[model samples]
Target: MVERGEPVRLCLHIGMPKTGTSLIQSVLQGLRPQLAHEGVWLPPNNLAAHRIAVEAFAADSRLSTRADVEAIREAITFEEAVAHSRPTSEEFTKVILSSEYFQQCSVPLLLPLLEKMGFSSEATSVVAALRRQDRILVSGFNQDVKAMHRSTPLIWDPDDAHQLDWYALLTPWAETFGKDAIKVQVFDREVAKKESLTCLFLEACDVSYDEASVTSLEVSRRDQENASLPADLLAFKFVANGVTRPGEVDWLIDEAQARGVGGGVYGLAEETVQAILEHYRMSNRQVALEYLGEDGDLFDDVVTAPTHTDLTVDPVILSSLLAICVAAQPRAEGARNHHLR
Candidate 1:
């Protein structure tokens, strides 16, 4: 399938999260100048492509009968804004959307949309990175607690046990599109680090790797403070619409240091992480064997995650987060007009 504005070449970079997706995206952003020099347009629309893909997947009854299209549509609205802001230029001809969450959608749903949009399997390249299950969950939970979100209940199991079944999310890509077209890399947070991963990913996206180093600038606006909820709070939030005052939640979250609660409190048990990993690994192992055989070991290898001390938060992340929050909230027409003035 082909898209009107999309160049003949398209790359869909899906992911196994915490695999330096943010860092990769930032680096990709820097390459926009160089990419434009090469006639490539990394449309801002893909900034939230995963959310759109997921929403689309859920909304299509053929893919997910219980799916909520409105939720997904709302998520894609941010990407739409980015698309709207793009300037018409001859330098950009191709477009790419990068996100890990896109992995959540079912292939059946994605294929039809792409076909309908004129993007065929032949014209698309899929990219994703994998990390050790053990460490991925640890960092993911830490992110959740920092944002005052809910953590998983399973926290004491083995490493590689507490995650969404990886195979369930990834295997389909290899199945739908030949494994050769699906670029899967095991992310070793230590060896390549963030910048290195960006370099590797850019190479996959058909972009230049020599242009610049990864920026500390955070561009995504998604909130990460999801820790697991206490039963009552969960019930209230999910059931009662959990109406939270804007900015109030952030202030309450800032008090974490005084409370002496470290972010680890939100992590799932080690066993749970391991279980989740093994559950998916079981299915993924089959795909690996089918695709790689003896060479499958290369794909199954683990990438060591970096230590907390090494990960730094860029202040820019705050601005981007605020932008997303404001976008999600309802604004009065007069207020929007006043701001514009």
Candidate 2:
């Protein structure tokens, strides 16, 4: 438990995406003021502050520019200002920073940046939520289609050493922060049945979700929080991406959603799913034993392999494709009209 007068503890929620990360961020951002009152600080200036901080430290040439530096500096200044404004009786006990992109950052680069932000390595804890590999891959593929607007699936090499290897992903942080400092929670049905992802996360951060916090969250709750594209919509988007200009994808997504054309799940054959899982089986065991302190399977349930063939288009998905084609016509006509004029 965090003591009120202790030096601020920084909690970094680095994500392995498709693990309810966006919802967690949305809830925290929405309840920032109430959380601050409770002495937990989720910086308001840039929700992606940690992402930018990681990029800036990794020296991504694009983010290393003066503008990026100033942006991070501004965020730091804002956090400090917020810290100072708290009532004299309470000092911030924890600072929560989240970013899914931090999963890509190396610990060597990430640690120095956290130190610069007033976090001591000893006082910081890294929290991550992980999903089964098969589910993660399918969800990642869907995210690429929806968020990245990719016409084709992202490159997948079954033999690739790093992709989807839970152990590899967690090892660096465990090595640096010590295995005890790293907390891993399985994102599965059993956990979901007991508590929400938001609540699970708050617990990990040592933040209390008292009656007031629950009421505030309920009041501001969105009907859809980081909802995924329905499989049919996802399939339609996949096909549309092949022909549409990159800049036009967002418009296409918005138009499709407006028409109420959605529903479909990306799937893999049982053999394929099992094979992929086997590839990471050993690493997952290590992670479970070493970091999670679990002797059994890392995930609570085995992924239910799909009976149907992968990426099979059924009647419903076909209908969604038709809707997308019809939706694109108006945009195409408008573009032609502008050209003629």
Candidate 3:
């Protein structure tokens, strides 16, 4: 809370990605006026806080790992835009910096930085909304593929499942922010289905939910042409560094969709979803109970949709054919650049 004469204390909302951050941020960004009226100023153009945070973390000398720097840079680039466009006001207004990548933040890198930024353990509220670990991982994999326009289905090895642990995501933030300062919530897909979850989240932020209908809850992912891979997915796995253009990736996604080469890359099987939940339950029961509360049953039900199969172009649409023809031709970059390494 800002006193009449005191500078407003910043409240950072570090996200764990894929947990509805895009929808919430989009809604808040759209309702800037409404938010300001309630003492919550959502900056319309200051959207780079994520990038700033990442760059800040990457530049920190305390952490020696290159992976940490790379991750920090990505998060900082995405978040910095949100932090720089704060609303002007005499009253204390909450300035939020949100991104989903912070789930992997290291405490040593996060703690001292928060202190340096005037966010004390008491002033900082490290917020994270967790889904069941298994589901989060699968969704993350799909999201990764979507961003790169890869058509192959992401296969999981049970041995590598530790990468998706919810506890691992939370423990660092909790340790750095202090357990009491962290407000961790478990996501209920059913509540999202009922359209009540957004309101609940806004309410937690002390913002009104009257404009929920006008606010879009659309999930952000890569364009439709980038979500799945074909049977020949390995060729695109390691594109040559400078030659692989993003447009070529979209073209590949379109071609794979046209040929119907993969199943449910965007959507996972029901059993597979359930198995993930079970795996999380077996692996991270303590973490779930600690973060989600003992009574929370949101993880019991697995959420899924049927495999998408609409890969064909409309037969009678001339414009669609023309668009495809234009897309099919190489756009300065092609197969020569396709390599992950």
- For TM-score, the strongest prediction is 2
lDDT tens digits, residue span 106-153, model 1: 777777766554456777788877665655656564544333343233
Q: Please write out the lDDT profile of model 3 over residues 186-270, one tens digit for every residue.
A: 6655345665445656655555556545334333221211233431332232231125654545555555457554433344566
Q: TM per model?
A: 0.60, 0.78, 0.65
Query: Order of candidates by lDDT, top first?
Result: 2, 3, 1
What TM-score does candidate 1 get on C-alpha atoms? Answer: 0.60
Per-model root-mean-square deviation over C-alphas: 9.7, 5.2, 7.8
Number of colliding residue pairs in model 3? 37
Off by over 4 Å in 1: 1-7, 45-51, 60-72, 75-93, 155-163, 189-195, 211-249, 252-341
Order the candidate numbers by TM-score, best to worst.
2, 3, 1
